[model samples]
Target: MGCATLTPVPEAWRSVPQAARITDLCARVSCASRGATDVKVTDGKLVASGKDLTPQFRAIQSFDVSLERREVAFAAKRSDNFDIGLVSLDGSDIHWVPEDPADETDVQWAPRGNKISFVVHSRTGDLVRTVHIPTSFQLTADFPYTAVRALGWEPAAERYAVVLTSPEASERIERLKYSGEGRESVVAPAVRLDVAIEPLADALLMRPSTLHYGERLPLIVWITETPFEWNDARGALMRNARVACAIVRQPSEAFWTAARAVAWIDLEKVYVVSGAPAPSPAYPGAPLSATSVVADPKIPTGRYRVDDRIVRAPPAIVESVAAGWIAEQLKDRNGPR
Candidate 1:
C-alpha cells in the first residue's frame, strides 16, 4: 500500500470542538498618563504606547487605567472565577486587589485613585462592590439588576453608573449612590417598564460551549417548581449540546412575556420543561408558545396527555433525552448550528 498523509478535521466539524476564542480583552483602548500613553489589553498582554508591557500568562477580561498613578486596574481569571489586579504602567510591579470567590468584572479606577469599583456576580443576586485603596475598606451595595459593566465614577466616588441588562438582552444605564455602611440605592435613570419588567433575576442561565458572537441559538427553559442545583448530567447537557438553557424558579407570567423579546433567542425553538403542572393563562394572552413540553413523570400531566410520543425515562437519562429531542427539533427546522 502507498503511504498517505491524514488531514486533521477542522474544529467546527469535530464533535468535541473547543471554542474559537476565550480572551478577556473585551474593553477598548484605555488612556493613561493624561492621554500621553494609550494602554489596552490584547492577546493576554497589556499594550501601552504600542509596546507590550504586561506578561502574556494572565488572561485579562476588562481593565481601566488610573491617570494619576499610571497604574492599570484589570480583571483576570484567577481560578474558576475572575479577580481584580493592579499592574504598573511599566509592568514591572504587580499588586493584588481584594479577592472574592464570585467573579468580578469591569474594574474601574476612581477619579483620584482613592477607590476602585467592580460588579460581583453572586449566586443570589448581583452586587456593586467598591474598595478604598488607602483604608482597604470594602463596601457593597446590592442591586436587583444584572450589572453588565461599570460606566464611570462621580468626582466624589460616592456615586457611579452601571449598565444593567434585562433578561430580554436590553441594556439601560442606572446610577447608584454608595455609602460605606448603608445599602446603596438607585439614584437616577429609572428602570423602563415600557415593555416588560425585568425578570430572570433568580434564573440560572447556561450557554453552549461553542457559542459565537451575535449568534442566535435554541433555548430550553427548565421551569423548576423547587430549588435547582447543578449536577453532572445538567453540566454535560450544556457542555455537549449547542443550545442555551435557563433554569427558572418561581417563574412568573412576566418571565414568559419578556423571554419572547430576547433578540438572541430563536423563538421557534424555545422549549419548556416544567417540573410542575402547565402554567395557567396569566401569561399576558399566551405570549410564549413553547415548542415542546418535557414534563417530570412524577408530576401528573395536566394539559398534555401521555402517549407513545412521550417516552418515560429515568432521571439519569432525562437530560440526554432532552438534548436529543432538541437536536431533532433543530434538524426538522433545518436550522444553522
Candidate 2:
C-alpha cells in the first residue's frame, strides 16, 4: 500500500525555525547551547542566554527545551543528588527538585507540562523508583518500574513509554502506560541476538533493534559481536526475534532485516535507514540520501545524509522532523473538514 500523506505546514509556520528552547514559544528562533555542566537557551531577540541554575553539577543528564513557552526543564547530576530544574525564558524564575542519588537513570516532563517524572536507582543500583514530581519540586513519589532506561510522552498526551531492560532476560524494550496509573503494558519487545564465529578467534553478530520516538524505528543493522569483522563470532548463540513499534493509536509488528533500518514515527508511519544499496520491489531502489528517512504522509524528502555504517541518526534532526510532522498533523486535524 502507498504511504499516508502528511499535511504540509503553512509557509508562514514552516519558515519559522524549530523551537530549541522553552522561550522559543514566544520568540521566533530559539536554540540550546550546553557548556561544561551548564545548558542555556538563546533567542533571536535576547542578548544574553538563560543559564542552568546548578552550574556546579557534574553533568546535565537530559532536558527538553520549549521554544513556544520560552522554558527549559533539565536534570543535573551532582556528587550526592540528582537535581531537576525548570527555568523561564528570561532565566529569572528557577524551580528545582533535588533528590538523593540512588540509581536515577532519567527524568522527563509529564504530558500536562506541569510535572516531571524521574527514575531513582536503589542504593545497590539493582532496583529503580519511577518518581512523580513532588509538591515542592523537591518531593518525589515512587513510580512503577519494569527496568526503565528512557521515558517519553505519547503524541496524544494521554500516555507515555518507558524504554526498559527486561529483568527476566538480557534484553531491552519499551513499556507503555498512562501516568499515575498502574503497570505498563509492553509496547516494544527485545530484538533477538544472532551470533556467528570465524577462524580468526572472533565473532560476527546481528540483532533486532528498536529506536524510541524520532529514532528511525525498525532499524536494519546487526550488532557486531567482536566490533570488527563482519562474520567473526566470539559470544553467545543467535536467536530469532521480532522488533515491534507501539504507538498509542498505532502498533506495528516488523521482522528484523540485515539490510534495512527502521524507526517509529508514530502508529501509522515509519522512518527507514539503510546501509547497503537499496533493493528493488520490497525495498526502495536506493539508500535514502538524507541522514534518515520517514515513510509517513507519503515519503517526504529531507536534506540530511544517511550514514551506511552507523544505524543511528542525529537526535536533534529526528526530533525536528517528528515535531514538524506532528505540527502539520495537528493543524490538519484542527482545520475545516
Candidate 3:
C-alpha cells in the first residue's frame, strides 16, 4: 500500500473575519449615509465632505460610522500603539476614546451609537472593552482564546459575538453575554481558585502543594509558543524554594488572567519569562527588553531572556536560569524567598 500525505489548506481561505467585519461596517455606512454624502478612507485618508478627518501623519487601522451619520469612530496609530479616534463628519472635535494604553483595533459602534467597542491587545490576552461615550465607563469581556479578529455587538442585548481562532488554527464564532461582571479582581487569600471557567484551555496554574499560614510567594508566568513538560522545572523550583510557576500554552487567553487571579502571589515579586520576545508597549511595564523592566508606576514589569543555549538545553537548565533571575530581582529587597 502506498502512503498518502495530507497537506493543510492556507489560512487565508480558512478565516477572513477582518474582511467580513469591514464589509459589514461598509454596508452599514452605505445605509446610514443615505447617499447624501460619502464617508470612507480614500488615498489613505479619512475623507468626508472633501476633507481629511484624521491627522495627516497617523495611519487609520479600522473605522465605523454612526447611525446618524454625525460621527466616525476609527482606530489609528498615534505613536507606538493604536488608539480609537472619534471625529465629527464635518472634521471638527477630533479626539481619542478614553481607554487603557494598549493597541486597540476593530472599532465598532453599538446599534444606538451610544457605546463603542474595540479589542485591546495586551500581554495577557485580547480583551473586548466597551466604553460609554458620555461617562467613559468601561466594561471588559474576556474570552478563553486569543487572536480575536472581529467583534459585533447586539442592539437589544448586552452580548458580543466574537470571531476568534482556536489553538488548532480553526475559526470559531462565540456568543458571550456580558452583565458587567466576570472580571472583578479577587482580594481573598491565595488559594486554589475554583473559577468555573468554561472551556479552559491547556493553561496550567502551578503552586507549591502546601503553604504556611498567611504566606505569600513570588510567581513566574512563563508564556511560550511551544509547550514543554513542566515536571522537571516544577520539581527543580519546588526543591529550591516555594516559587510558583504557571505555563501558558500558545494561543491560550489565560496569561495574566491565571497569574493575577492567584490572590496569594506577591504582586511585587511577580516576574514574566517569555519564550518569545515581549511585544512593544503591550504590557503594563516597560517592554520586555533587558533582564528586568522598570516598573510602570502602577505595575511591575520585567523580561527574562531564553536564549538559544537555554532553548537547546534541558527544561531544568532553562528554569534554573529563571530562578536565578528572580532571586536577583528580589535580592535588594527583603521580599519573598
- The root-mean-square deviation over C-alpha atoms between each candidate and the true structure, in angstroms, is 16.0, 18.1, 14.9
Q: Local distance difference test, per candidate? A: 0.55, 0.35, 0.53
TM-score of 1: 0.47
TM-score of candidate 2 relative to the true fold:
0.36
Strongest candidate by TM-score: 1
Q: Residues 1-337, candidate 1: write the lDDT tens digits.
A: 1122222322222222222221221222122222445887778877897777666745788888877777888888756777888887866666877687888887888775677788888655578788887688988877543444445565656666555443323334455565524323333222221212223545555554444688887776765532223233333344445666776765566666566676776766666654343444422422344543444455322212233223222333344445544454456355453
Per-residue alpha-carbon lDDT of candidate 3 for residues 158-249, written as tens digits (9 for 90 to 100): 66566554222233455565443533221211112212221223454556556668877776555555332223333333445556655565
lDDT of 2 by residue, 63-140 (tens): 665444555666665565556566665656567665555535465555544555566654212232233444543333
For model 1, where is the 10-residue window of minimal lDDT? 17-26
Candidate 2 achieves a global lDDT of: 0.35
Query: Any residue pairs clashing in model 1, and if so which?
Result: none
Q: Candidate 1 or 3, higher lDDT?
A: 1
The candidate that wins on lDDT is 1
